[model samples]
Target: MAQWTVVRAQHPAELVAASHLFDGPVSHDGAADALARPGHVVLLARTPDGRDVGFVSGVEMRHPDKDPEMFLYELGVDEAWRRQGVASALLDALRDLARGLGCQGMWTGTEADNAAALATYRRAGAQVDRGSVFVVWDELDGEDVPAR
Candidate 1:
């Protein structure tokens, strides 16, 4: 039972401050660019003392024939703070945000071998779409794209 507050990041400074929660280093320029985009969201879970312990980023997807849905981009929690419901809290916050934005649904992809991620998502009420497969273009213009 850890005590933390979940907040949507409205500023690049907020994202930069919580950079460590990201898989890679977050640059000020990148953070600013992300914040400027519509339908992109970044939520931070911070301790009472102002330490960022977790984060979840999502993007709203729109289709001409369908209502918008949220695509959960990434989720991370400080290793030391794991197993304390931090990730669940972050997911809950993101889910609430999606509902607030009128999204019809939310989805995310994780490797089949990632047991921890699967468990976390399942605990948050996510159902496995066994028929769904994730495909990616890891390379473009003869250069390898870094995995997020």
Candidate 2:
């Protein structure tokens, strides 16, 4: 059995241990600068052998008409470690972190076609908002998205 260490990283150096688990360059100085800011959070999972296996990143959001909530930005696990509870554990840890930060709730979104993600979120006790639709405006792709 592999023991896992789940932690909320407050500094880039603390995140270096699980840098490989991230898809992009998130352990550099620029990333450190970003992590040092308020709202952003990165929760990492390390194996007993000291290998980084998974991570979940989130942000705290506040609005004029609502209480604070956490937006789960991303979640990923190493291919070899999939279905081994890494994702769920990371999410649970993030929920704890969110509550500690006084967030009233936490939410995340994934494509309806992403079975793995939907399953993981379900296992983590997330409710699906079937009535909501997700849309994006890709300005960098040169597509014009008109205001609704």
Best by TM-score: 1
Please give the RMSD of candidate 1 to the true structure.
3.9
lDDT of 2 by residue, 45-121 (tens): 88777677898999999999999999999998989988888998999999999999999999988898899998889
Q: What is candidate 1's lDDT per residue for 13-87, written digit by digit as tens?
A: 888888788888888899999988999999999999999999999999999999989999999999999999999
TM value for model 2:
0.85
**Which residue pairs collide in model 1, if any?**
none
User: Number of clashing pairs, model 1?
Assistant: 0
For all candidates in order, the CA lDDT equals 0.92, 0.84
In model 1, the runs with Cα more than 4 Å from the true position are: 142-148
CA lDDT for candidate 1:
0.92
